[model samples]
Target: MHSGLPNGEHALIVHQAGDLSNSCANVGPIMAPDKKFNVSAIFGNIKVDGTKNATIDREIDWPKDISLIGRSLVIHKLSVMEWSLRNKDILPLACGTIGFASP
Candidate 1:
């Protein structure tokens, strides 16, 4: 069981050309999924949506534009979720996610 991004899925390189980073730097609105632009650098907000909650790393700096609408969201898993819940902060909610109170 190999984990991590599978083949054909390239990591987003903020410093290079690819997608999801250019428009963010032009001081314009970016709705596309891929491109090179410092999104948070200009826009200031990012939003995502999805049916199942996903696991996300806390070290990543989210795009900041304030116009996040209609996109898939990722949430942390059990062990990670517990760490978040134990701390003082609202856990991020993904699309179509169902959460139960801890026992």
Candidate 2:
């Protein structure tokens, strides 16, 4: 993790001076009713901590018969999804808000 960033959030690699962007997460089942996951017939929570100290907190609410885990998700500081495409020079992830939020 970055030397200046808070500990125990994202999976960051610590270097001699600080941290870089080679981080990840388990994206596993969590404790809460986050209705955003679309799975968990009962509401569940999926809290994503990203670079720049940005966080995506939501609830997963689905019908009792249906369950959906995050097959696909994006870690971005973007206010909108299309922001990724707007950048032709910078990689979407790089230009995403995470850069500013990350240490």
Candidate 2 lDDT trough over 10 residues, lowest sum: 11-20
TM-score of each: 0.20, 0.24
Candidate 2 — which residues are off by over 4 angstroms?
Answer: 1-51, 81-103
Scored by CA lDDT, what does every candidate get? 0.28, 0.27
- Candidate 1 matches the true fold with a TM-score of 0.20
- lDDT score of residue 67 within candidate 2: 26
Query: Which prediction has the highest lDDT against the true structure?
Result: 1
